[model samples]
Target: MTTILVTGAAGFIGYHLSRRLLEDGHEVVGVDNLNTYYDPALKLQRLQRLTAYEGFDFHRFALEDGDRLQALMRERDIRVVVNLAAQAGVRYSLDNPRAYIDANVVGFLNVLEACRHHGVEHLIYASSSSVYGANTQMPFSTGHNVDHPVSLYAATKKSNELMAHTYSHLYGLPVTGLRFFTVYGPWGRPDMAYYLFTQAIAQRRPIKVFNHGQMKRDFTYIDDIVEGIARLLEHRPAPNTSPLTGSAAPYKVYNIGNNKPVELGRFIEVIEQRLDIPAIRDYQPMQPGDVPETYADVDELIRDVGFRPSTSIEEGLGRFIDWYTGYHQPISVAP
Candidate 1:
């Protein structure tokens, strides 16, 4: 069985992807620091599920620790590497920029170095939809210039794409960078708007509606993200042979999004409908590093991997609430 290494295996998307890999009978080596970004308990709970599988092996450490990461990759004989470890949250980055540099930039460099020396066959890493900063264009495309990033988090992720391209060009390491849109569903991040809004509405608290409820997001579901990543694992990029781009690099980037931009008001309305309660909406001005809307163009993703995220917000959020109720137990708060 081919062994693959997944960083940030304790985080939201990482946990889901690792579990999916284990269920497919692939040997997976998971690495995570399990920091108190939100709650270590939730991360541990997710890890506990993967630990149940015989093919899953986990190590607790930050990706910035190059020595440990290299050792783990070498020892595990990892054929593929999926680097998902990063200090997420755009607002958090504004407050703590160093965290983003330490995790997303330094940590990602370590991952690249490990893949290079260890002879990894394929390297798939997470890019962000936030990288399309200041571009008001409809349905952000990968071919568009992403030189401008509004947030430190977006800048770091954009840096990752550049770093991966360097590695691919220099060492012939095949790399695929996925620009994920607003991903939401079960086992979601607490800092995310969907989860936060759900919690507030459940507690009979006023939910903050930023930008005066004028925001739009292409909320791709977690299952769809996992499916897209799974399909791209085997489809490694080959060196570009086109004359338009002179450099021959085995690197590619794809946007994995639902391609359906739902308005913020409609999204909250869906949540209210699913939970059978109305939310106390508190309108607020736009926060820093916030975008007006995000709609991804997944044409390249479909052409390359033959898969596209198609989960509607209503169906996805319904599944999330069902899981949330069961996981959190009897709801004491108002609905």
Candidate 2:
């Protein structure tokens, strides 16, 4: 079993991925700052679940702390470093730009340094579907040019890809960036649209429909995402024979999405049905840094990993609603 370091262990994706790794008999070291971007209590709950596994180790520290990160990586003999920690949310970045620089840019740099110093075999990190910003392309592809980002959050993620490429080229680090689509599932982040939508619907509050209720998103399920990462954990990138870059670096990027985009109104319909309630619609203008739509081209991901994500919107929403009701019991969501 290989020893792995998973940054952002308490976050939605990190927590699920780490749990899957531990179940497969791998040793895992998880790190997180537990920032109050949403709720630290949920983050702590995730950590608590992970602690039940003997093979999982927890570290509560921000990734920008280079010294601490270096020490943890060096001491653990981590073979694969999955950097998942970042300041998420496109709109949140508009409110607090400094958080993006600190967590996404600087924290990522520290991770790259540690991997370089420790001779990490494979470096896997989270990139977002938002990196496809401003592109008129129907389905986003990793080979496509991602120079026009609409939001600071997207820009930072794009910057991460470029920064990771530099390390891969200069230091021969085998880096793979997985561009995640709008992922939703049980134990999901409270800040995500689906999570909030579910909450608002349950509370009989107005659910905001952005883009004048015309936007679409490639809402990926969490289980499919974790499975893709688990498979890629063994599929490290090789030196570029024909990489997106001219430099011969073992770096690559893939769009890990459901390859299906669901319109905003339809998504809300699913949530309302699950709650058996008629949602009070609140039509709002698109916020800054928000995209009109996101569609993923997972041909490359399927070809490379021999896998394709296949979860219907209804099924995924049902699972989430079940978890939501259980988590917040004694509160009736009867429509």
Candidate 3:
């Protein structure tokens, strides 16, 4: 029943989250620039689906436009803001560092300001597991200090956490940041490894296996992510009362990931099984801005939200393959 705003509404996670909110009877206002970071066709298709819902409203604009964003938020009387929009992809950040700053950093600041001035009740934004850069810890936890980030993308996300904390401390904003692990599902980003591998296998092309196929990821499904966000929307963070850091700011951060980590080789095997196509493996050195593993510790997420992302790679990938084959029928393998 609340009027909620979702940035990046045409992106994979944003699209799914917006649909879920609409299905739950909430008035969902979605915003996206629909940039060519990926195929605009896919983004348009996702928006097409959302347009069917009566409760869903769409706005096409970059969040970096502070004035327009402020006007939209104030006009809509946005109660909750879910910031899922950003210049994603760690490797992409290397070639295009400015995009990360413009979208992730500058754009996020606009969102924070809008929320602060608009009297928004709750603000939930996306952080990433990549923030645990260079840390060889088994399960990355929020309690662990994430001072070191290997990529510009990770650094920006960490910066977002810092910015959100500052807003909470200064303006008494109730803010929550969810550090997402490897999120994948239907209508997922084509830039992700699984999506790329699927395309390669379908074309009988050699798929690049970085670090000689040695990597691990906690692949969380889209449903689990949307479910976590839905739960958190109702459970806003209260003022911090921890004696260790006695600042009474209403801020919290949680890792929303499947505690289970799957090896890169094993992940590819699942794709091959579902596709019935043997992958031509092209083993390569580890790319820069890449990590060997990402395992999220969801203990606090479980304790606070009473939910855990339990989607297994097998099931999640199977569902993704189903959607992929159906969506991209007569699969196009253009260079």
Candidate 4:
């Protein structure tokens, strides 16, 4: 069983990945600062479930503490590192740009440093589909140019890809970056559109339909994401010496998404159907740092890992709403 270190073990995706890893008999050392980005109670809830496993261990710390992180790596003898911890939210980053830099930039550097010194075999980190900002590219591909980023969150994610490439070039580290599209499902972040919309609809409140319901997102399910990640755990990248860059760096990026873009209005309609309650949509202009549409081109992910996310919005949302109703207490709608 491989000893895996998941940086954001308490997060929505991280928690799921850690649970899957533990089920596969891997020794998982999870680290998180348990920051109040959203709701720590939710993070704690996810963590509590993970702690029940025999091979699961938890650490309360931020990734920026390079010294402590290195110590943990050495202490745990961590063979593979999945860096998922970050200050998430595209709109939040506009005012809290420093938080993104401190966590995504400075914190990621520490992760790379720890991997470099700790003899880690593979470094797989989270990247966002937001990096394709202002591109207007249908079915965003890894080969497409992603130099333009509209949000600080997107910029930081792009920076992560660049930073990983640097380490892979200099230290021969096997680095793979997964650009996640709109990931939603059980135990999802409260700040996410899906979760927030569900809460609003359940309480008989108006759900804000951004861009006047013109938005589209490649909503990937949590299980599909975990499956993609689990499959890639052992499939490390090799050096690309194919005369493109003329350098043999073991670094690659793939878009892990459903490859199916669903309209915002249609998504809400599905939610309404499941809940048997009509939604009152507050159709508003697109907020700042928000994109109109997101579509993932998973050709590379499928070709490389032999798998891709295919969970339909109906099946995925059904499971999420079921979990939500069971886990959450009664909701009080605002008058």
Which predicted model would earn the best lDDT? Answer: 3
Worst 10 residues of 4 by lDDT: 326-335
lDDT (10s digit) by residue, model 3, range 15-57: 9999999999999999999999999999999999999999999
Candidates 1 and 3 compared by lDDT, better number: 3
Clashes of each: 0, 0, 0, 0
C-alpha lDDT (0 to 100) for residue 104 of candidate 2? 96
Report how far off residue 116 is in candidate 4 (Å).
Answer: 0.5
Give each model's whole-structure lDDT: 0.92, 0.92, 0.94, 0.92
- Per-residue CA lDDT of candidate 4, range 1-335, in tens? 99899999999999999999999999999999999999899999999999999999999999989999999988888989999999999999988999999999999999999999988899999999999997787989888999999999999999999999999999999999999999999999999999999888988989888889998999999999999989888899989987867779998888999999999888999999988889998899989989989999999888977997989999999999998887763653333
Question: Would you give me the overall lDDT of model 2?
Answer: 0.92
Q: What pairs collide in candidate 1?
A: none
After superposing all C-alphas onto the true structure, candidate 4 shows an RMSD in angstroms of 1.3
